[model samples]
Target chain A: MNLISEPGAGALILRVQEERIDAAVAIQFKDRLRELTAGGEGPVILDLSQVTFVDSSGLGAIVGAMKLLAPSRPLELAAMTPNVARVFRLTRMDSVFRIHATAPETALHVRAAG
Target chain B: MCAPPDDAALMPAMAPADCSALRGGDDCFRRNFRAEPLAVRDALRAAVARFARRMGPDDAGTLELTLAEVLNNVVEHAYAGLGAGPIDLTLCHAGGRLHCRIEDHGHPMPRLAAMGRAMPATDVACTDLAEGGWGWALVRSLTEGLAYRREGDRNLLTFEFRPACR
Candidate 1:
C-alpha cells in the first residue's frame, strides 16, 4: 500500500493504492496514518476512491487510528469503493465518520464550512 | 453445465435441512473446479456473496470473507501437489442464515482449531507468516459456527453464519 499526500484545498488528501485492505496491508496503512497525524496536521481527508476491498483487520486499523487521534484531530473518509463501503456499512462505522461522495467534495466541505 | 436431475441431488444428506436445495437456485448454488487456489477463492467469494444476499445483509461481509479465506486454504494445502482432483462447493441460505460447505479430496483433515492460537512473536512480517496461519485466524473471527472433518478421503469444511437479527 502506498499513501500519497496532496495538499487539498483545505485538508490533506491521502490516496490509497491497493486492491484489498486486509491483514496483509492493514499495518502499513495504519503506520502511514500515524506518520501523517504525528506530523501535526490540522485535519485530513482520505480519498478511498481507489480501495476496492477492506477486511476486519483493515477496519480495526482505521478504528484504532481514530481512537489514537481522539479529540485532537479529525479524519474523514471520501469516495468509498463498493466493497470498502460495504465493510463500513456492515460494521456501522459509516455513522461514526463523515463520508463524502468524492475527494474534491470532501476537501471542499472542510474548506468552505467549518 | 446441465441442471441435475433434482437440484437437491447436488447436495446430499450433508446439506442443512432448513433450506431449499438446488443445483442452480439463487438460494443454493454449486460449482466444481480443478484444484486451483485462486479460482477457488473467486468461486467461494461469489457463492458466499450470493448466499449472504439471499439470507440478508446483516454481517454479510464477515460471512463472505470467512468463506473465501477458508476455501482458499483448502485449495492451497489440501491438494498442494496432488495430481488432479475436483473441488466442490455448495452454498445455501434460509432461516435468515447462510451456510457453505467445501469438499476436496486432499490430505486428511487438519487441526484447524488448534492452529487458531494468537500469532507467534516471529510472524509480524509478511515473510514470517506461515501460509495457513492467517487464513485460519480469519475463519475464527468471521463465522458464527464452524466444523471440519474427513469423510472417506474427502476433507469437508462447513461454515455457518447466523448474524444477530436485524
Candidate 2:
C-alpha cells in the first residue's frame, strides 16, 4: 500500500494507491492511515479513487482508523471508486462518513468551515 | 410446463444415469479455467444467471457474486502455490437448485476446519488488508452449501444454492 500525504487548504489529504483492501493488506492499510492521521491533523481526506475492492476486514480497518482519530480529528472519504463504494454502501457505512467527490474540494470545505 | 405428479415423484428416485441425462428442461455449460480467470468468471456468471432466471430474477446477482468469490479462491489459492493446470468447471441446474462444481489438478482441498480456527476477530484492524483467510470467509458467507473432496489427483469443490429460496 502507498499513501501520498499532503496538507491542502487546511485538511490533510491522503491519496491511496492500492488495488484491494482485504485481509492480506488491512494491517498495512491501518498503520499507514494512522501514521498520516496522528496528532489531530484537522479533517483528513482519504482518496480511494484507485481502490478496486474492499471487504469487511478492510472496512473494519478503516472504521478503526476513524474511531482512533475521532474527537481529535475527523476522517472523511473522498473520490471512492465503484467497487470500494459498493462495499461501503453494502455495509450501510456510506452514511457514517462525509463522502466528497474530490480531495481538494473536501480540503477547501474543511478550510472554509474551520 | 407442468409434469405429472407421478413423474415429479419419480424424479427423485431416478437412477444416477437417468438423472445425469436429465436436463431439468435447462441447458448446461462447462469450461476450462486455465487461460483467463476473468473471462471464465464472466462466462460462468452469465451461465449461472441464465439458470437462475429460469427460476426467477431475484438471485442472479447473488449467484454471480458467490460463484465469482469461490472461483477466485480456486484461481488464487489452488493455482498459486501449486502449478496451474486446467481447472474443470461444470454448471448444472435441477430441482430448483443450481449446482456448481470446480475441480483442479492442484494440491488437496484446503481444510475448512483449520481455516475456521485461524480466523481473527472481524473487528481486528490489520494494516495489511490484502493478505490471508478472507477468501474462505467470503465463500462461507455467500454460498448456501459447500463440500470439498479429493479423489486421486483432483480436488473437487461443490457449491449449491436455490435461487427461488433467496
Candidate 3:
C-alpha cells in the first residue's frame, strides 16, 4: 500500500508500488492519494507500470481520487499495465484523464529531500 | 459452503478426481473461502494458477479481473451485514470459454433482475462521476452469459467468458 512520489517539473507523480489494487486496498489507496494530492497545485500523475491489476473497487478509488482534486488539480494516469489500462479504458476513464504511455520525463527524485 | 468444495488452494490442484478416479474432460476448479476481500484475493490467485498454463496472459488477466469483481461483490454487498460468510467458486474451462459460478449464503442481491443492464453514466462532471457502482458494469462488460438467481438461501451467479484465441 506504499506509493513512491517523484517530483515533476510541471506535475506531481505518485507511483503505486503494489501489484494489485483490488477490494483489499481500495479505501487505503484512495485515502493515500488524497493525502498526497491535497496541497499539490499541478496535475498528479499516477505511475501504474507496477500495477498488474485493478478491479472495480480500485477503479472507484481512482475516480474518487480524481474527483477529490476536481476543477483544480487533475489526477492523470501513466504507464498503465495491460490489465490496469483495460479497466480504465473499459470504464471510459481513459478519456477523462490525460493518460501517458509512460510517465513523463521527470527525474526520479531520490529520498535526499527529507 | 452450501456444498463442500475441496479448496484448490489447499489440495494438489492438478486434476479433479471423482468417485471412480476418472478425470473430467475439462479442467475444473472449485474453491471455498470466507467472503472477504483478502480471501477473495487468495482464491483469485489460486484460480489463475490453476488455469494459467492453458490461458494466455490477456485471458488470464480478464478472468482474474472479472472474478475479482464478482467475488468482491459477494464480500462487499452480499455479506454486508452478515459479517463473513462462505463463498463457493467453481470455474471450468471448456469449449474455449471459462464458465464461472459463485455461491454465497448472504442477503439476496437486491434488484437482481436489473443488474448490469446499463453501464453507470461515466459521462458526467468530475464531481458527479460515480466513485462506486462500476463493479457490475465492469463485470457485465467483460464477461458473457451473466445471470444471477437466489436458490432458497444461497445466491448462485453464473457467467461465461470467451478468451480470445491466441
iRMSD of all candidate structures = 17.6, 18.2, 15.2
The CA lDDT at B113 in model 3 is 50
The digit string of per-residue lDDT tens for model 3 on A78-110 reads 778777777776776666676776766666744
lDDT of 3 by residue, B98-159 (tens): 78999999999888755745665755666777777777877888888999998999999999
lDDT of 1 by residue, B1-166 (tens): 1111221111101122223222233367788886664465467567756655433443455566666566656655787788547888887666555667888899875665553565323213222322224456556666766788889989888877665442
Which one wins by TM-score: 1 or 2? Answer: 2
lDDT of 2 by residue, A1-114 (tens): 798787777788888888666545777899998887777568888877777556655777787787777655767787776556655554445555677765574432343455
Q: Which stretches of candidate 1 lie over 4 Å from their true place?
A: A1-48, A55-114, B1-26, B55-58, B83-85, B110-115, B119-132
- Count backbone clashes in candidate 3: 0
Binned by DockQ into CAPRI classes (incorrect, acceptable, medium, high), candidate 3 is acceptable
Which candidate leads in TM-score? 3
DockQ of each: 0.06, 0.04, 0.26
Q: What is candidate 2's lDDT per residue for B95-152, written digit by digit as tens?
A: 6566788888776755668434333333333232223344455556556668888889
TM-score of each: 0.52, 0.53, 0.86
How high is the TM-score of chain B in model 2?
Answer: 0.67
Best by lDDT: 3
Poorest stretch of ten by lDDT in candidate 3 chain A: A105-114
